[model samples]
Target chain A: MAKTVHPDQRYLLALLNNDAQLINEIYKKCAGKVKSFVCFNNGDANDAEDIFQEALVDVYNQAKYKGLELTCPFEPFLLLVCKRKWLNELKKRAVLPVTKEEDSLLHIGEDTFEQAEQLEKQQEQSKLFLKAFEKLGERCQEIIRWSLKGEAQEKVAEALGVTYGYLRKKKSECMASLMKLVQLNK
Target chain B: MAEDKITWTARFVEGDLSEAEMAEFEAQLQTDAELQQHLENYRQLQQNLRQQLAPDAVREALQQTLGKLNSQYFGHETQVLSLKPIIKWASGIAAVLAIGLFIWAPWRGNLYQQYHVPGQMLVAERGAASETELDKAASFYNDGKYAEAKSILEKLYSKDSQNAQLSYYYAQTLLATGRVEQGRELLTTVYNGESAFKYDAAYAIAMSYLKTGQKTECKSWLQKIAKGTTHYQKATDLIQKL
Candidate 1:
């Protein structure tokens, strides 16, 4: 499928590129909605602030790791994430009362909800990825991170004083080892 | 079958397969579900790789900016939490403060002495860039003139954010001046990035974590140092203690 860039691609690009003005605009534009959602629930202003920041960080993560193309508008998607996260927080804190925004997100169809779910799922997988990467010997972690970064395999090999073929074989072995670690973690 | 799968999977992912070879691979892919699953995993892995594993600076920057905006917009309640209570208990606070300082000042001094290491200054010798502000900052930094070094280093860092020498030395000055958090932030940037001082910054960052009582993160940073770096031995020793 052809990737469609949203009109508010600027919000995401601002986040990915760390554009200060645009980031401020995101808080100006979207944060109020999140704050309202959190505050209207049992969350205080501090809780609202924390939830909003956590949600934005997840959005940043998705954009950084997955090239997150906003399928729906940004606010709904962001609010969905905030609501889901706040619900999780409440659950973790053993709050038995359902949040007031429980059915507020019912209009966000299966796809948008699925995307939010995917973000949460990706968060778990990313933790696993980092854990597995760290579990490797330092050489493998360095080689895999640098190699995956589109660094020329030959140049990396030369830097390490190994042949290109050896680099490729070693990289593959390291990646396979990482995959095994992730699988075992799963 | 296994050998063919390995070679062909690698070749296909590499886009090194010829037209006929591609045709054969696709034909096999149609019949072989496991091959299909394997390729999907490869695709996910490749996607994971190309997306650049967590630079973190961007996200942190955004969060900092957004936090400021939050204070501006929804910060009415926060301001009301002022020092009124302290004013009410001013005399009591002064007595407590005097007692606290008597006991606390030496402990704070000891902590700084334990963790702070002044960075070695760059001398204008043998092919080094001579008589520059960077050199002045380095000299001041090494001489433990962190106040002068920090002022000069901040000027240099602001003027040329890309200069690794300025950033690295400035980060050290920041650390020396008891600004551990800001110093660690820059050290993190230096170590994660391509810099001559990456290994040094790695060691400094681990030390920062140690000083801050974050032993797990300290161990992780120490573990990332390759064996050839100057800090590798010290890092391992520190890791053992942690």
Candidate 2:
């Protein structure tokens, strides 16, 4: 008997299966708790959002690659992940000198220790990508910007007053160009 | 002829050509070396344009736009509903609806759910033999054991006629194992309402068609998924690439 799975397992399974709406519902159910934790740790709504996204990605990756079995409720698991992510973000910001206001905003409780190391590792990849992104061209920058925002070529073309044909060409060209730039810079 | 070819290549790369003109351009490119070179040059020009733009301004503008859109769409109260959460909710609803339909409205609901599951569970007191086998096949498929997986799935499908999961996975397995035609057939069956994995099955079928270089067939199936609710984002993503 494949033992009757827990609710969190079912929720995680739903996420792994790429059922977007169900995942949203679970996120809605737990977002407040996660947000509170983030805010208490001297984070803002933007930080909460970033942490939530990273936590979800982490959970999704764990489920897909490592076959992670959920031993706790979805809320606590997600909250734990997001809490650690926010704390690390604060610590990274700390390495640079900060004003009195900024200094006061950097706080992390001792309980956030367990996942802090993991969050640090995850942040490294994102930081590297951001650094690489800076090396790309203006057009490459715009193309990637619109692309990430789920902008259609037609929309991008209309907004920029270019033809759809030019937009597609530009997008592929920009990606290739960025790849080359990243390579050259490296 | 070369002048005419270059003009067509530019138009095609610029996305100014109609479908018919694009087709003609591709056909001509197959036999015309000059046209191919011109097309490559056009591609390089586009790349150069990208290399000259400013990254920070573009990123800042994009981020601002995304932030505005996110707030507008979700509102502050519902901002908690992130992409991950939305996916989770959709899956849960889909599964509950599937199971509910299976019980309350057996004929219609089961039929609908069946289109998605690929392999229907056996009702034996000891649980279905095919369920365990299909699970094994899934594990194998995930592990990149296409051949071993396909063999098990195929055997189970032979024993169980209407198992959608089996048929769907088998089709995917076939594609992975290099049996494109057979995989296509099974995928078509699932896509055409012969099996349960309707949305995902259709998406897979379209992807398989793409793998076989049948862009037209791939587009058609992709269009179907794009129109449907469940697989819309995936379909949209693929169509954009095409």
lDDT comparing candidate 1 with the true structure:
0.70
Where is model 2 more than 4 Å wrong at Cα? A1-186, B1-131, B226-228
| lDDT by residue (tens digit), candidate 1, A38-145 | 777678776777777767777886887787877666767777887888888888778854566445544675557777888888877776677677678757776776
lDDT of 2 by residue, B77-136 (tens): 542334664555466567755754454343443222222222222211222224555667
Error of 1 at B139 (Å): 34
lDDT of 2 at A10: 81
Docking class of 1: incorrect
DockQ of each: 0.19, 0.03
lDDT of 2 at B201: 76
lDDT of 2 by residue, A1-186 (tens): 543334568877765665656665665676676676666667766567656655665565455433556644556556656665666678876842122322222343333333334444533533444456656664666566555444566887787777876777776555545444444554
TM-score of candidate 1 against the unseen true structure: 0.55
True contacts kept of each: 0.32, 0.04
